[model samples]
Target: MSNLYERSLNVIPPVAARATKLGVVKGEGSYLITEDGKKVLDFASGVAVCNIGHNNKAVVEAATKQIQQLIHGGHNVVYYETYVKLAEKLVELTGGDTMVYFSNSGAEANEGAIKLAKYVSKRQGIISFKGSFHGRTLGTTSITASNSAYRKNYEGLLPSVYFAEYANCFRCPYKQKKESCSMECVEQFDDIFKRIIDPYSVAAIIMEPIQGEGGYIVPPKEFMKAIREICDKYGIYLIFDEVQTGFGRTGKMFAHENFDVKPDIMTCAKAIASGFPLSAVIGKKEIMKNWPAGAHGGTFGGNPVSCAASLATIEQLENGAIENGVESGAYLKKRLFELKEKYPIIGDVRGIGLMLAMEFVGENNVPNGRAVKNIINYSVEHGLILLNCGTYKNVLRFIAPTTVSKSEIDEALGIIEEAIVKEC
Candidate 1:
């Protein structure tokens, strides 16, 4: 038998997972075909990047046409139609009058947003929540305090960030009785701001409208409205990091829309280009005022190819993709809820739209890590690629394509049910 996995040398810094066998050969709609000719149902959607689904003809054709015409341009010095179109679409969807800065990834977009917040406010501190996963880059890493494993080795410079517990709702951070809790998390932030970070010193308060990697934690509409009021009262810029929740992952185009609140600045990347690497920091015009000609620039910031793909993706979303996302996401969540009722291991199955997750907790409501891991591993082996996240690594996050079919969801759920039953 020919070994699909073979050699390893030195040059490449290996990832913690399986090494020497970590290549993906090709991707079709909702599946990836590996080099060894294995078809893997991609539920993770490349970490929630492929919103429109894989091999989408519109995205591919747009990218191909751009590549055939122009490959590179100093984007800062040029006024390309594709880039301008993208900015226009973003503004229209956000329902905010703002400027935009293009970047290579969500982290870069967030970094730009951070700089803009400080530049506009001249404030030093940034307030972020615990159990948040921003990105691996230095600036974003500073705001993120998710896992110690990701934070252990890297030392040098994370500073001036304050943390307040967000509305976990399911798992109360204060250990307060669930019945008596009245969004005390928001009240806790009042104390955090007064004692730890002076409102004047806080440039921005950044958070995911719906916590993505912290196990799809969805807060109540009132919580968001309350925060908006706090930011308004304090003149602190509210930065919504919609890197995972934007572009129809949530039932609304932007999760913040679900609430009657809006952010002063928003950063997005995943699902922005429908599998292409493109991110943007969009903010109110006043906040974006200090942007000099060259303050932020990347070699591939808005490469025509990616921009074209993004424009096409955005157009499709505006037309009907997002509408379908709402319907399909509702269906997926409902089906998962049905499964949860049948299975006691599913502690909480909650989400909005296609952004969904199941937190596994025992009968006593403590996190069940082994059961969650078994379900994930078994589902992957059974043709459905499952993902895990949470402070305890016990939440099963489902981020398949927004275009995922009901039939596919049914099949995946069946496999998950069997796995949980067998494992438990």
Candidate 2:
């Protein structure tokens, strides 16, 4: 029989990019069992979607049970047990002041979020950050600025979308030093409002709490707090694209919690359902209430099985995976920093919790995409799977499962170090 990768070539399109061509057969914890009988350490975690680890028994069991009970009750028509229960749990988790609108993917959730903001606030303009990846949908494509390739063929997108700078302190977009930095990332919005689009016309200001695809860039708390204040000042909906940073990936239930700031609207997916195709637009109840019925409706927005899996995923996160991520993330960061000290090509190592990254650069601190490609190739050859980020494709991101063991982490790190030494 032909391998999955080879079989895909005959039918699958090239639009969906794969970081590795491994023919994965099974997943257990932090390891992927390949069709060729290779047990590869999975640090990518399906782009941080398998937070509680792949094929988790609890999640699988819950989904299976729900599948038998009610696979698709049709959210637009009627509510099911799992669907209502999951929403209740999320509302409780978000302090009981928020309501959720279910969708099929991160892109759909973002579309709903923007629509929610525009509907409730009755505004036309949207402010997004440069080097941010919201989603692939046309409406979201308009706001995404991580790479031009994403919006290459699809120009003349949703209008009134403006881009601003994200605070990547290591490679500050404003090029300001940490010691003397004056929160220019925050002030850039004022310039945008003054010269670009009027803040009053802006419906929402969306951002990744920890810029994911633009590289795992974590901004300072002050910057997030300032953005919160700006949104409050102008009645703009503050939207946090927590699709990548949610579900214990950031050491907290949500990345925004780390900065002690909450968004008026939040788009979540990825780990929300532990690999299930589910996403949600969580918003303040006050705003969500005003979003009249028929304003948004999807046939399979909150599938019963996906909702069941999400509830189980949440239980796993609360049980211990989140705490494990906190401890393991610190351990991983320390090791990566040590690697940075040893290798000159490793320019910057930064991230929060399990969502960490190391930017590869040349002698003069110029982005070295070639080094990243080589290192990733070497890592895959050595049984360690990894992913790359940054618009320049020079950042190596680590999306190891939250439940990863110290030994598994050590093994992946050793492979990475060996790859850097031999390849870069």
Candidate 3:
């Protein structure tokens, strides 16, 4: 029989291309058992979805138990224990002032979030950052500006959508340095509201707390506060797309917590259900209550098994995964900074908790996509899996499981160092 990758060539389209041709038969903790029986250390963690590690015992048991009890009860038609209980838990975790609407994926949850904003505010305009990745749906594609490829040939998208520059201080769109920064990122809204669409016409301003696909860019706390103020001033809803930054990935329950800025609405997924398909639109009760029946609905929004898995995932996060992530993240980050000092190719190291990244650069600080590609190929060939991000694909992001140990991180770093020494 042909291998999985060869077999897939005849059946799967190129649109579903993968980072590696290696197929895995099983996963345990931080390693994947490949089809050829090789153990690969998984540092990408399924793009931050397997937070508690692949096939976590608690998540597996919870999902299996729920499957034995119930499989599919249309969320729009009926109530289920796991679904309702998970919502309640989220509400409690988010301070009891928020309500949740379930969806199957991050894109679906984001679509619901914007719909809720528009419905409640009765506005048609939306504002998103230039380097933000909301989702792939046409509705979300309208608001996403991370890459032109995502929007290629799909023009005439949802109208009344505007773009703004995200607070990427490292690259500073305004060309301002950290020492003498003038906060142009915040002030740009003034120009936007005056020169572009009226603030009153905007239903929502959506952004990722940390730009994932664009680059692991973390903005300053003041920037987040200013955005909240802008939304409040214009009576527009503020939405944080936490799909890749939530559920302990940032060592906090949510990335927004670190900034101490509360958004009017938030969307979460990725690691919400361990490895299950699940997402949520979490909004303030006052705003969510205004979104009436028929405003938004999904057939498989809140799968019982997925919700059970989410609850178990949350349980694991609270039971020490997040704390462990904090410790490991600090260690990894420090080591990365050391690597940056040793290798001039490492232009910068940034991110909070385990969501860290290293941007490779050539002379004069030009993005070095080729170097990143070479390093990743070498690392994977040597038994480690990694992923690249940024519009230029020069940013190597570290999405290690929050349950990762110091030894695992050290092992991964050793592999990374060897790749860098050999390729860079």
Candidate 4:
């Protein structure tokens, strides 16, 4: 009998290569039960999608009920209860001054966000940060600069796009020490506008509030404030792609809340529906209103079941999972910092809430992607699942579920410690 991975090899494309080969049959809180009945600690959280944990009772029940009542009430054709309620809840969450447009994925939502900005601002140019991963769509791929491979054969993408630096204090783009650093990231945009294109031509400046795939890099609060100021000065809309940072993954309902800087347009997905395929473009009501009907429409933007699941996910986050994320995230970070003391090759440890990461580097601060790969493989073989981030692929990111317990964190850290010791 061929195993699931072996069978998958014949049918699945190589582009969909996954982190693990284990055939997961079920999920309970922070663990995944494999085909062979091995219980693996899933710290990746399906790449930070299952915020409230997989197959959560509330989410499943809500989704099940909606599935029975109404499976697909296309947003364009008509409205539904779960869909309208979820949008209402989100609007309220964003301070009741914002309106939402639904989409099926993060990339789709990003496309909507930029289009909304362009529609309202009547501009064509966009400014994005280097090392940002917006999406795989041609429009998003244009803004994404995290990996060149993503744009290999699809060059000459959306034109009028400019890239700026993001704050990665550990591997500062400007190569300046933190103590002496003066927020060059913010200043880089000034040079961008001066040397590249006029700010007035830029419709939107899209960015991941916390650079996720670009290495879990958290920009300085000052940098965020500066970006806000520039956008205000130029009348350019600020778009925060919170696809992976929203829905209480960062201890708060949204990552932007941590910085006290709200974007004119925000895109969220991933954890919004626990594990359902759903996303949204949330914009200031004034801006969203300008995006008239027939300007944008999706046949299956807001699935009823997904919206039900999202409402449940939000309820779960508010109930206790988000609080647990704060406590466990701190505990996890403290442990990683301690591990850093033992492993100098573990160059930097940084992140917010449950979205944490440790950067691996060789002597003289050279990126050590090999170490990260080895550690990940070893951990998987030893019953722990992990993932990596960063442009160099040298970052070990810990995306544990907000519902994760301290014991699970300790277990994952133990496996990681042993894997590092054995591999690195």
Candidate 5:
């Protein structure tokens, strides 16, 4: 029989391409058991979905129990224990003043979030950052500006959408340095509202707390606060696309907590349900309540098994997983900084908690995507899996499981360093 990758070539389209071709039969903790029987250290974490680690015992048990009880009860038709319970848990976690709407994927949740904003606010304009990736749906594609390729040939997207520069201090869009920064990222809205679209016309402003596909760019606390203020001033809803930064990936339950700022709306997925397909559009009660019965609906939005998995996943995160992520993230970041000092190719290292990244650059700080490509290939060949991000694909992100141990991080770091030494 042909291997999985070989068999896939005839059936799967290139659009479903993956970072690696290694087909795995099973996963345990931080490692994947490949069909060829090699144990590959998984730092990709299924692109931050298997956050609590692959096949976590509690998650497995919860999902198994739920499956035995119920498989699918359409959210639009009926209520279930796991689904309602998970929403209550999320409400409690998010300050008891918010409500959640379930969906199947990050893109779906984002689509719902924007719809909620537009429905409640009765506005048509939406503002998104230039380097943000909301989702792939046509509705979300209108608000996503991370790459032109995502929008290629799919023009005439949702209109009344505007763009703003994200706060990337490293490569400031306005060319301002950290020391001399005038918060142009925030002030740009003035021009946007004046030149692009009226603030009053904007229903929502969607952004990733930490730009995922664009690069692991973390905006400053002041920037977040200012954005909140802007939304408050204009009576426009603020939406955080936390698909890649929610759960325990950012040390905190959500990345917004790091800035001490709250958004009117938030979208979550990826790590929400261990490896289960689950996503949520979490909005303040005031806003969510305004979005009545028929505003949004989905058949498999709140899968009983998925909700059970999410609850177990949240329980794991609450117990000690987040703390481990904090400690391990700090260690990994410090080690990465050391690597940066030792290698000129490492132009920058940034990100919070386990969502860290290293941007490779060549002569005069030019993006070195080739170097990143080579390093990822070399690392995989040597029994480690990694992923790349950024519009230029020069940024290598580390999405290690929050439950990762010091020894596991050390091992991954060793592999990374070896790859750097060999490829860079």
Candidate 6:
């Protein structure tokens, strides 16, 4: 076969140039079997989507049984037991008698949260942080300032979206040292809230408990607490984007649980459905009460099949995997710290639970995304898959499925070591 496919789709993007990327035949647990029968360790886990790991028995059975019964009758009018049950489970897991509105992806969930915030508070301005990635939808895109590529050519987007500095210990955007900083960025809030816009004009303060696309940036404890206080002071809702950190990815049911600071509105997706397209806004009862019944919904927002998968996924996490995330996350973190001592290219290592990142920096701690790219490519060539993201794209994000075994962890680490030292 001499590659007969023509470049016929310019409407999508000319940048999507590659064809015949690695093909996978099947996935079981932490390994994906390639079309050529090669076993590749799935460290990325479809960008942290497959938290229970690939081919979970219950998830497969639930999807299969739902398919046999009913795939999709449309979620708008018709009622489905699975959908209701999953929502109930969400309410239970999230606690506080919270309500949920379903969507199809992380972006949609965030988008819905934005609408809900404004609807309830009747406010317009939305505040986000630099290096934060909410989603790719127009509304979510406006808040995402991590990369120009996501915003370029798509300007004049959703307006009134403000940007603050995401917590970066090494590169503190607030002009403070990591150890001595007094959560000074919160001061920026006073200026913005008073002069830039009235407190009543603000809708919500959207942030990640752990900044997901922001190099897995983890703010100090008091920082998030102050954010909560700011939201409270202004009567603005705090939206925790738990798309990547929810469902045991952060070694807790929700990342905010660790800080004792709760969000008024929280969005969850990705792992909620064990790879199915299901997401939701879990928020305060009063705040979410403004929805006028059919205010927000999707054709497949709570598709019965995906809901079943969500139920099963939640069950898995609640049962024991949250604990597993803690144990394994500690083990993995310790190992990465060791790697940092050996590989000077690893300028920083940070993250919680199965979510982690290794920043490649120059001697002066300048970001080196090129080196990170080289390591990712080499790791893939050596039978492992990894991802890179950050303000500089100079970080290797290691979000292995929590179901991964100790041996698999060691194997992937070995491949990463070789890629770091030998690939250069």
Q: Looking at candidate 2, what is the lDDT of residue 121?
A: 93
Q: Write the per-residue lDDT of candidate 4 for residues 1-424, one digit (tens) a residue.
A: 2288888998999999888888888999999999888899999999999988878999999999888899997898888999999999999999999998889999999999988988889999998988999999999999999999999999889988888888888888889988898888778877888888988999989999999999999988888999999999999999999999998878899999999999999999999999899999999999988889899988888899999999999999999999999999999999999999998889999999999999999999899999999999989998899999888999999999999999999989999999888755
The candidate, 1 or 2, that scores higher on lDDT is: 2
Q: Please, what is the whole-model Cα lDDT of each candidate in the order they appear?
A: 0.83, 0.93, 0.94, 0.92, 0.93, 0.85
lDDT of 6 by residue, 1-424 (tens): 1112332343546665532256677998898887678899988888888998998998999888998998887878787889888877778877756898888899999999999998888789999999899999888999998888889999989989998876677778876897787767777888877778877889999999888777888888888998898888879999999999998888888889889998999999999888888998999888777778777777778888899898888888878877887888889999999999987888888988888888899878888988988888888888898888787889889888877778889999999898889634
Query: Over the stretch 1-424, how does candidate 3's per-residue lDDT look in tens digits?
Result: 2299898999999989699988899999999999999999999999899999999999999999999999998999899999999999999989999999999999999999999998999999999999899899999999998899999999999999999999998788999997799999999999999999899999999999999999999999999999999999999999999999999999999999999998899999999998799999999999999998987897999999999999999999999999999999999999999999999999999999999999999888898999899989988998999999998999999999998999998999998999888756
Model 5: runs farther than 4 Å from truth? none
Ranking by lDDT: 3, 5, 2, 4, 6, 1
| Tens-place lDDT digits, model 2, residues 1-424 | 3389888997999988788888988999998999988899999999999998999999999999988888887888886888899999999989899999998899999999999999999999999999999999999999999999999989999999999999988888778997799889988888998998888999999999999999889989999999999999999999999999999998999999999999999999999999999999999999999999889888889999999999999999999999999999999999999999999999999999999999999878999999889989999998999999999999999999999999999999998888898755
How do all models score by TM-score? Answer: 0.95, 0.98, 0.99, 0.99, 0.99, 0.95
Assess candidate 5 and give its TM-score to the true structure. 0.99
Q: lDDT tens digits, residues 1-424, model 5?
A: 2299999999999999888889999999999999988899999999999988999999999999989999998898889999999999999989999999999999999999999999999999999999889889998898899899999999999988888999998888898998888998988999998988999999999999899999999999999999999999999999999999999999999999999999999999999999799999999999998988887898889899999999999999999999999999999999999999999999999999999999999988898999899989989988899999998999999999999998988888898898898756
TM-score of candidate 1 versus the correct structure, residues matched by position: 0.95
- lDDT, candidate 6, equals 0.85
RMSD of 2: 1.1
| Clashes in predicted model 4 | 0
Off by over 4 Å in 6: 1-20
Per the 3 Å backbone cut-off, how many clashing residue pairs does candidate 5 have?
A: 0
